[model samples]
Target: MGDAPTQQVPGLGDVVGYLDSPTAVCGQRLSVHLSSTVGPTRVRLRALRIGDYQGRGSRLVWQSGAVTARQQHEVEPAGPDRVITERWPVATTIAVDVSWPPGMYLIEIAPLAGGQPSFIPLVVRTSGAHSPYLVVASDLTWLAYNRYGGRSLYFGPGSNHTQSVANRSYVASTDRPVDASGQRTVFKMTLPLVRFLARHGISYDITTDSSLDATPAQLVGQTTVLIDGHSEYWTKRMYDAAVQARDGGTNFAFLGANEIYWQGRIERDARERPTALTVYRQAGLDRLARADPATTTVQWRHAPLLRDPAALVGVGMSVVGVHGAYVVNTAPAWLLAGTNLHKGSVLDLAFGNEVDAQEPPGPHSPANLQVILHGTAMAAGRTKPSLVTAAYYNAPSGAGVFAAGTTYWLCELDSTCPGGPTPRATSGALEQITLNLLRAFAVPRAGRLHPSAATPYESPAWLAKRLPVGGAATGEGQ
Candidate 1:
């Protein structure tokens, strides 16, 4: 919110719009769509690079002169998925050349004739970048929560939209503007981590989930891949690419919880450009499941594809609406160096909203999975309390992976997390832990140099009982 107004207009009835796409490479042209109740409104737009720049929070990159913006009508919802597409004419077009550096950007549109000012977030990616660190924004998740045009994949306008199955869209188009709620998600979830990275002078490349799907090669050869903030939805191509990267010795940091829960795919227009995000909530009943089962948008651990999420992140989602704090259980000297955390020390309100834990009697976790921090929360719609676990593991490929198992990890850095403010001592401890994790993962073949220690459950005595007498007992057989 640097060059843009901090307060957003009340509703979508004011001036609102979105870009033709969420991402762009240098030398590509971007179209900005606009609709306004104030006809012939004088519009002033600017592109601001988003991050913490000495506490200013943003830097102005480009600005556009006054342009005439007119009211554009919205197209009605179509198809069983209730796909909402805005066929608004382009109010302005911006040429993204080498002058604009590659990073996260936002286009601020202000109507001078008295209307609301809106913003369209964009990520400028570079194809040739092979930075030591890469941050992938959860753009797909942002769209999933976007309530623009009166419908989202989850919620709608009235009381009828409150139900999980009724009045929801299976497919949502990117042509519509992101509402105020989606904008708040960016500030609350993603921006704090971005600021922390920038303040630490960590040189990294940033891209969106859709861009990674379009060009998977961008993910290869990176020392570390960091996925931040509530990244619940994933495309098959994106999931496959991440697995391939990990297998090839690229480290990963899942800094947020509830990741890769559901499968989704991108739909394209006749021109072969990505148009809508499609996901069938109840994949078993989907008509497409009869023909192509993989295309169904079921949970990752469900039928047809029984790939459990714990196998990837070392923990599976357990409870939602959790407001507990992380209590240190087994902090390795290497991971928790310089921090005052010890066994049984609690970090105030470090876990909340949603969390993950090791699921027993279900799918198995990765080899040498270590639970460093633990928390407990009352399971949603249930009376029993569930445990939340933050874990780490070293893959056979010599790639290190750590899962935070909570959505509010980064939010603690900038003190923007909901529920309450994190104490200074708690914030410092988490920040140091993050710095240590990032610096370690930035090294090539991190697992080879700093292999994970055996957890209590993976001790020789624990493994001996599960194996044959003469057979060797390795930590890998959990």
Candidate 2:
């Protein structure tokens, strides 16, 4: 190329940055290494702000904005070349000192040299009584959701006519706060849940789509495991991190559903504009196979070939639509320990409310696997295979993998009508079963513990007695 076009080039976002130390103990000194292009004149590091995206009406606003500690630095001179490095001390106030709960944070950097500000999404994690550290990585692209701002992975504008019309007329109701109970977006539900956990003295960390590369060393200080609401996306790095943590004695629990299906590879332009993130689906299995066969394989999909196939339900694919009626088939597994169900007969325990036109099942179905619930399968209208639910245990690492058949079931616990606010006939029993399994998996064999403490929260017998009974509703059992 003769010469590159001169324009207002954007710098890297929050997720792309270096840190002085990868791990930090409680109340210790930590420094973050930040680099950016030196455009023409001196590029000065301005203020850093942290906030969450809120508001409605097509545009999002950062509801909370607070300035971080100030850092002033200059670029190193190198023969008309442009690039600078700066280090800022991270004390307790800036989130390195105190025990930062597990979760993702959006870090934004403003430049004084006049350009669009850059953001770096950081994933901070801690293991049980160990050190906590930050990990920098690229954002996972193509993962779909209802309210996270990008295109809906499953239910989009054209996915359903009624939904498309409603979305157009959808307005954020000021009467109800974004964090209110009946909110629509997964993030809305997740934010409050995080608040609830913090109030109850639960320690945790958050990793976002960008910082999916957070290593096991950064998560060794956490005790309880937590996955945010409707976290349906995953990359090879994310899968490896979680698997390693679980195998190494870290307690784990997925608060959401349909996780680790669509894989993405992070891509950044020379200007770090985040040009495009590529998605990869397996051969004969992508959503667009009907449109083009040559585009379905890993090479065309652009995502790293996932080595661990068990991490997904439909052989590393997405679960589309809802139509089946999921009942609590078994009420006696370790997942349902406290929920004392005597024998047979559990009902109305379906997860993932929004139903899509389902499709065929995957080829590698586990025969010996116990069916927790049963329901009708829908025809995959325009999407790929319809994965109802699946579970697998990695032989070598012994890490248990559970994939909800549908994405709507991601929020099986949210109390609401239609799906029902309170637990259904066997919903409580099912919840207890899940809790039991998680607890069992968390504790080591030598130090295993019960699903619940001294007195369990809800008894299985009590739940069975309170089960709801009636004829099936319209979409009860598709």
lDDT of each: 0.76, 0.35
- Candidate 2 scores a C-alpha RMSD against the true structure in Å of 14.1
- Cα deviation at 40, candidate 2, in Å, is 30
What is the lDDT, from 0 to 100, of the residue 398 in candidate 1? 92
- Alpha carbon lDDT at 104, candidate 2: 38
Which prediction has the highest TM-score against the true structure? 1
The sequence of per-residue lDDT tens digits that candidate 1 reaches over residues 219-297 is 7888899888678888888888998888899999998889999888788767556787877778755678778887678
Q: For residue 322, what is the lDDT in candidate 1?
A: 60
TM-score of candidate 1 against the unseen true structure = 0.91
Question: After aligning candidate 2 to the native by TM-score, how far in Å is the CA of 146 from where it should be?
Answer: 7.8
User: Which digits, one per residue and each the tens of the lDDT, describe model 2 over residues 1-478?
Assistant: 0111111112343222333322233454434444433422222222121121121101111222322323334323212111112233331123343443334333334444445544333334333333221221212321222212212222224467677433321111111001111123322224333333333333334444443443445445344445544444454566666667656655444444434445544334463322223343344434454565433324312333424333322123333334344544444345555766644444354544332111223333322233443343334443222333323222223334333443334234433323344355444554555455545554442123322211112222233234331222233211
